[model samples]
Each structure stands twice: as C-alpha cells, then as structure tokens.
Target: MPRYDYRCRACGDTFEVSRPMSEASESASCPKGHADTVKLLSTVAVTSRGGAVPPSPAGGGGGCCGGGCGC
Candidate 1:
C-alpha cells in the first residue's frame, strides 16, 4: 500500500489515504462524503547520509542556527 494526499474540490479539504496503487489513482474523493475531489501531488521529505552536507554556524544557538536548513 501507498499513501496519497487528496484534496476535495467541493469542500477544499486536504487529507491522506493509504490504499493499493491501482485504487490510489482512481479514488480521489474524501472519505467524509465529498465526491468532487482530486488527488494532489504531494512531496515527501527524505534525507541521505553525508550527501553534500551544509556548513553550520560557529556559535551554538537555540532553535535553528540558519545553516542552510531545507526545512
């Protein structure tokens, strides 16, 4: 099974569903009873080990250090 994000055209609500690949593309309606819905092309974040790592700031700070954070 694969997870897919769907947006309801009638209600403008976004939700996620986990289903089979074949049904994923066909089923785009919201489970809350919205029929005029479409599947949205959502992105998933993934990280690689030691892949063009960015440099960090010299000083240690709280929260984000502003070191080329992708998030």
Candidate 2:
C-alpha cells in the first residue's frame, strides 16, 4: 500500500490516505467530511535495505582508465 497526501480546500486542512497504487488517482475525502479536496504532489525517497551502499571500485570505475587499457 502507498500513502497519498490531500488538501481540503473547503475545510483548509490536509490529510493522508492509504490505498493501492491502481486507485491512487481517485479523489479522497477529507477527515472533516469535506469532498472538495485536491491531491498534493509528494516526493519519494529511496534507500538501500542494508542502510549503506557499496563503495565504488578504484581506478575510476571501468571506462578506459580502470587499469585494463593502461590509461
């Protein structure tokens, strides 16, 4: 499930809803029962599951100067 943010123009409040991605485009009612709401643009942050990424290899990583072509 994914969460989406929405702003209620009539009540001047913001709320969140959790639903399937297929229904993400559907309108959401505010918590105050206001039907006049607009979906808000949200940002997503991605991270590695291990909490850290592997370091890059030496020799500048593979183009022509990775010590294979002697550059």
Candidate 3:
C-alpha cells in the first residue's frame, strides 16, 4: 500500500490515506467528511540503507573519463 496526502478545499483540512496503487487516483475524504479534496504534490526522499549516499560520478575529484582525456 502507498500513502497519499490530501487537502480538503471545503474545510481546509489536511489528511493522509493509505490505499492500493490501483486506487491511488481515487478521491479521498477529509476528517470532516468533505469529499471535495485534492491530492497534494508531496516530495518523497529515499535514502540508501547503507548509510551515506554514494557520490555522483561527475563529482569525482578531477579525472576526465579515468584520466584518459587528461582534463
């Protein structure tokens, strides 16, 4: 199941709901029983289970294609 955040336009209430991916697009009701709600554009941050995130290849100190280009 995936969790979704929704905000009610009528009551200005915010809530979260968990449902199957297939029903993710379905309308969510607010705590005040308002069906006129909209899904919020939320951000999800994923971190590696192995602690620190791996550095980007482009961020490598100073080697261009393994020093072949000698840049």
Candidate 4:
C-alpha cells in the first residue's frame, strides 16, 4: 500500500492515508471528519537495499565536467 497526504480545508488539518494505487485519486477525509479536503502533492524517495554504485570512467575522476561527471 502507498500513503497519501491530504489536507482538510474545513479544519486546516493534514492527515495521511494508506491505500492501493488504484484509489490514489479517491477523496480522503480529515481526522476531524472534515469532507472539504484536498490531496497534497508529495515526494517519495526510493533507495536501493545493496547501495549500488554507478560505473565511473577509466581514470575514475577526470571527465568533461569538473570533478563529478560519471560520463
């Protein structure tokens, strides 16, 4: 299940709800029972379990752009 953030205009309260992706657009009520609510745009950060490392150049440091160009 994915979590969605919603804000209630009636009470000006924010709450989180967990539901399936199919119901992501469904309306969510506030904890205070306010129906005038709107879904908030949120950001999700996904990380790898193994901490994978990206491949670098043969020289490992020198590239077109200063110090951190993996190309």
Give RMSD to native, each candidate: 9.5, 3.8, 4.2, 4.4
Between 3 and 4, whose TM-score is larger? 3
lDDT of each: 0.77, 0.89, 0.86, 0.86
Instruction: Give the worst 10-residue stretch by lDDT in candidate 4.
Output: 62-71
Q: Would you estimate the TM-scores of all the predictions?
A: 0.59, 0.65, 0.67, 0.66
Q: Least accurate stretch of 10 residues (summed lDDT) in model 2?
A: 59-68
Tell me which of candidates 2 and 4 scores higher on lDDT. Answer: 2
**Candidate 2 versus the native: TM-score?**
0.65
Highest TM-score: give the candidate number: 3
Among all candidates shown, the one with the greatest lDDT? 2
How would you encode candidate 1's per-residue C-alpha lDDT over 1-71 as one tens digit per residue? 68988889888899988888878668666778989888888887999988987765654343554434433
Off by over 4 Å in 3: 53-71
Q: Which residue pairs in model 1 clash with each other?
A: none
Expressed as tens digits, the lDDT of each residue in 1-71 for candidate 2 is 89999999998999899999999999999899889999999999888779777777666667686656786
- The local lDDT score (0 to 100) that residue 43 gets in candidate 2 is 100
lDDT of 4: 0.86
Runs in model 1 deviating more than 4 A are 51-71
